[model samples]
Target chain A: MVRHFMAALQKHKMCYALILPTFFLVFLFRYYPAFSGVYHSFFEWDGALLEEWVGFSNYIEAFQDAKLWRSFLVVIVFISANIVKMIPAIIVALLIFHLKSEKHQYLYRVLFVVPMIIPQIVYMLLWKFFYEPNIGLLNQLLIGLGIVEPDLPPMWLADPEWVIPSLIFMGFPWVGVVSVLIFLAGLQSIPNSVYEAADLDGCGILKRCVTIEVPLIMSQIRLSLVLMIIATLKGFERILIMCNEFGGPNGAANVPGLYMFRMAFMEGRVGYACALGMLLFGVILVLTLLNDKYVRVEK
Target chain B: MSAAPKWKNVQQELAKHAGILFVLFFAFFPLYIMLQASLKDNAQFGNNIWLPMAPYHWANWLTGWLAIKDFIANTVIVCVFGVLLTLAFSITTAYVFARYKFPGSNVLFYMLLAVMMMVNVASLVPLFTLLRDLGMLNSLISLILLSIANGQVMCVYVMKNFIEDIPKDLFDATSIDGATDLQVVRSVVIPMSGSIISTLAILRFIATWNDFVMPMLIMRDEQMYTLGVGLMSLNSGYDTQWGPLMAAYCIASIPLVIIFIFTMRLFVKGLSSGAVKG
Candidate 1:
């Protein structure tokens, strides 16, 4: 049995030997942190140091916090709004696939994905300008076109009701660009003959897309959806830049991630923020599970 | 010309121009606004919509630069080194996964995959404490190390996909000639995988360069700040030196810009590969 084991090891020595860097690195950083995060969640550690073991009290406090609940509500709204914005990317992907020429498909892709190449924070700055109320472009165009009366320009960021929607619009163009790029790639992978056969079968573009293109690209779409969800949930810089706080007006944009930032840095409630982090982690994990169910890698 | 051919030609010309026009408009619009805002005379900015200002030669970028040189340097050091170390670890790890199967390898690989699902936000507090306990606070190494470590999943994902695409027969032929795993990786694997590795490096570089939070949390001193944090400090108009601040922003973004311009093909390639799951 021992000789058999030695021979087996010799046969695959390289494989075992080759992966040590990744295993060691991941074990050091990711798994270690993940386990520690779970342990820390229960311990009631303030930012300064680990407090005496508090068990589920932190979790209970997390459940009871009214602000936390409000932040949770805001997260749901944020996620839904992001779903709305992601539609354009799906459409763009479909259109790119529909293009008769591969060259043209590449052309539009380069254009669409340009926004993503700029870092998220830089994009945030551009949107903040877009929402600038007194001298911003949107209202100027609205008044110029007689869409709104000259005397009444809508407040883009000032009023609490418009805050979340405005922020949502700012983030809309981003995912569409990146997702389109992903979906177009998936579209390309559907062997040409498959599409040619569909065409020979007398299926039109829209019909073929619904029946064929959608199924093949479903994995990519699901991935994009999950990504966009987590992105909106964990959004930080844009909110910080715009509101100059966790949320801009009346806690309207105050999702948990933003609230955690405020709790940690602004309010110095380190333990509460750690609890918020775990809650955010759980919520995201649930959504990710949903993502995995819908988007299988092997399919 | 026949009517069919004539019609086809006309439609093609129209579509071509229309796409270019749309692309140019969207691509250049925000940049135009950024440029205009950066250039407006003081009177033009505070009193009115900052537009139609003089076009200065990267003056805003210059303003950004002077305002945040030490900060930009700090960011550059952390990001450049962070990206390099990440590439070092990820490439070898990916190569191993692609080429060999060993005991518990599958388990380790999937754990890495599962880790990708845990967004960075979730682990920030624990990661902060870990850094503190390790006495990595306010250190440049802390940011670089964390950035490198954080990318364990992404790098593995990219590298694994690229390496898997290479056929096994090639590896066997090389192995029969007495090539070691390191030898094969150094010579055969790395050469064949040049395009993908280059692609991964570029993507990793951009990710680390733009990272805000890790550096924000880890680096203690003002001089240790990266571009993202440094830019934020400048954005407050603390120095109000708009020229240098803009300059610094331009400086910070230039490496990415140059890489984006040159290796756009690889960027698109990475996107497409990610689309093709497994």
Candidate 2:
């Protein structure tokens, strides 16, 4: 048996060869650092470890953190905005589906997804310029359109009450494209016969849309919702660049990802940051699992 | 509904198209604004929200963003090396995970997958300190290693899935013909997975080329900045010079646009087809 085992090892020496580099890479980055993070989370990890074992103190401090809860609320607000904006994405996707030809669909797809290719920081910066109070494009446009009096233009992003709404507006433009692209894909999967039958029933456009389209697109909807929630929760680069710490103008634009970054990296509370990181991880994980459960493959 | 007249249909179609047009405007407006903002002078940009009165098309494109011609070289170095290294490591790693039945492979693979959920921000605190300790604080090598290391997960997962679908006979026949495992991989597996490799290459190229945080944190030296970080710094000391920033943003995107012009169809198909396969 020992000889056979040795022979087996010899026969598959090449297999071990294939895996060794992968092990090295993972060891250096993912596996080592993950344990490092957990280990760091236990003690007061500064540049020096001190290797102190203050069990569960990090977790308690993170839980009690007022900023952490603030981040949570801000993230929830962003997610809720994503949910609201998803409706138009579906409508747009459905419109693309019912188009007369593939050319139109292709054109629409290319145009809509353009914003996706633009860097997040760049896009967010553009919105920041637009978010600036008096000379911003939004206020100027509103005034130009006679939507608001010249003097009565609202201060957004700068005002605490208006920051969330301003962010939602900025984010909404960037996100709907993905939702539309995903929905367009889902629409393609649905058989044409469902629509054919609906048409034969003498059903109006509204009825067919409600019955045939919405049900067929539920999987896409679930996926979009989950992706959006993850995205909104994962908000950082844009908000950070746009608002500049303190979540800008009374912490309205703060989310878990950005706030955790501020706390851990900026403030040097490494243990507390890890706990918050773990919470962020938990949020994404829970949502993804829920999405999988709800959005099962529909034949 | 079946008895509806053609004229009414046209009216409703116009409405839908109008709505779509409205959405398209929203979609394209920011980019248009950026383009316009690039052309305007610093003072003019701060004063106005829209296009400048005089079409300084050349000046707008020239004055601010164009001066960073030096950065293009640094960005190219990082992206080229980064993409090549990613491909090299990911292809082999993915092949191993997909074909070999080694001890602890599953556990290790799952651990890598877990790390994917931890975005770059999560690694910020320790990573900076770690790099500073190692004296790798402002090197391109740090960017290359970190990107390749972080990128291995998705590429490996995707590549493994692609390789799994190849016929087992191909590998078996190669081995039967006196080819070694490495020989089989080089001659058989990779050749057969052209589409997947091309797709992974494009995705990695774009991602690393545009990534901000990692490069920003690591490459603090003025001479060593990637295009992403360099562009951010363009506006930093100068009090957010929109003209130059805008110029730089547009100029930076041109390479991608030019590349996509040639491989646009393949690029679209690559993403779409991969999603379908997944």
Candidate 3:
């Protein structure tokens, strides 16, 4: 048995050699932090030393924290708004999919996707400029179009009421290139015979879409839905940049991710931040399970 | 009946074009504004913010480029090194998992896949301390190291899937010629997996180029900053500096825009594959 094991190990030595770098790095950087994050959450560590054992105090505080819960509400609204924006994306995809010529379809796709090449931070900053109260193009356009008086120009990122809406519309007409392309691919994968059969039944475009197209692309819809959820649940980069570190006015735009970031680096509350991180990890894991169990289970 | 349907088809086509045009405007308007702002002086930015004003301040690009040039070079170094490291680790790890029937392979592969789903924010505090202990804080290498480690899971998964599709006969043929496992991988697997590698490379390049969070945390010095970090400094609210800010934005986005124009096909394929397959 010992000789057999030695021969097996010697035969696969090259495979072991090949896997070493990734194994060492991932263990050092990824798995190590993941385990240590939980461990650190139990102590009042300042990144330099474990000051004391806090036990469950951090998690307890998180449970009772009104600010955290409020941020959670803001995050939920943000996520739902993104999901709602997917409708326009799907419609655009369907329209482009039904274009008369392949040439036009391809041209439109290139145009739509071109924006994605720009780093997303640039888009956030541009919107920040647009939200500028004094010289913003958005306010100028609104006044020019008589949507609002000059005196009543809405605050874009300042006032709490407008902050969330401004964040949602920052990427207005959010027909994401990836989502549209995925939807179009799903539409194309539907065999022509199914569409012809629907044509024989005197189905109009809208009716065919409602009954056949939507159902046929349910898988794709589910995929995008899950993606949007994961993205929004974890997303804070745009918010962090737009809100200028502190999650905008009065923490109105705070999500858990940014909240944790500020807690750790800004506030020196590393243990508390780890607790928040653990909570986020738990929520994401739960949602992922739910998505797998319910969202993708049907049909 | 034919005449009526033809008219209806014409109307439908017109409507489709209109809708597409509307979306195109929405997509391009911000970019148009960015370009216009990049060209104009701050004096013109106040009253004529909606459109480009007279006597374009083309010197803004020169000023902005000079300010952010070091950071841009730093970013290039980070991205190039990060992608190379990620590719090396992903290809080797994936090849082993795909071809070798080693003990515990299935468990290890699944563990790596699980890492992809974890909220990276959860690991931020510990990762910071980890780097600090390793004496890598506030350095470009810190960002590169984290990015490589962070990206390996997805890269491995993608490459492993591609490797698994290679015909077994090729591997067998290489082995029959007295090739070592490394030799077979080099001659057969690496050569054949060019398409997936390019797809992964471009994706990684775009991602690293746009990364903000890691750079923000890991690098403290102005010269050490990446484009995103540098852009944040330009907008640090001390001075709006709209002309220079917009100019810097344009300069920062140029490489990505050029890459997108050249490799739109591979990009589209990589993007859709990630979504549909996920």
Report the number of the highest-lDDT candidate: 3
The residue-level lDDT of candidate 1 at B181 comes to 70
TM-score of each: 0.87, 0.89, 0.96
When sorted by DockQ, best at the front, the candidate numbers are 3, 1, 2
Q: Best by DockQ, which number?
A: 3
Q: Give the TM-score of candidate 2.
A: 0.89
The lowest-lDDT stretch of 10 consecutive residues in candidate 2 chain B is: B269-278
Residue range with the least summed lDDT across 10 consecutive positions in model 1 chain A:
A170-179
lDDT of 3 at B225: 89
Q: Alpha-carbon error at B159 in model 3, in Å? A: 1.4
- The best candidate by TM-score is 3
CA-only RMSD, every prediction:
3.5, 3.2, 1.9
| Local accuracy of candidate 3 as per-residue lDDT tens digits, B24-137 | 898889989999988877788876877778798899999889978987898889889999999988888988898889766788888888887777888988988888889897
C-alpha lDDT (0 to 100) for residue B198 of candidate 2: 71
Q: How displaced is residue A229 in candidate 3, in Å?
A: 0.9
lDDT of 1 at A45: 61
User: For each candidate, what is the lDDT?
Assistant: 0.71, 0.73, 0.85
Q: Once superposed on the true structure, which residue ranges of model 1 sit more than 4 Å away at CA?
A: A1-20, A139-155, A193-212, A294-298, B1-24, B46-52, B55-61, B238-248, B275-278
Docking class of 1: acceptable
State in Å the error of residue B135, model 2: 2.5
| CA deviation > 4 Å runs, candidate 3 | A1-3, A297-299, B273-278
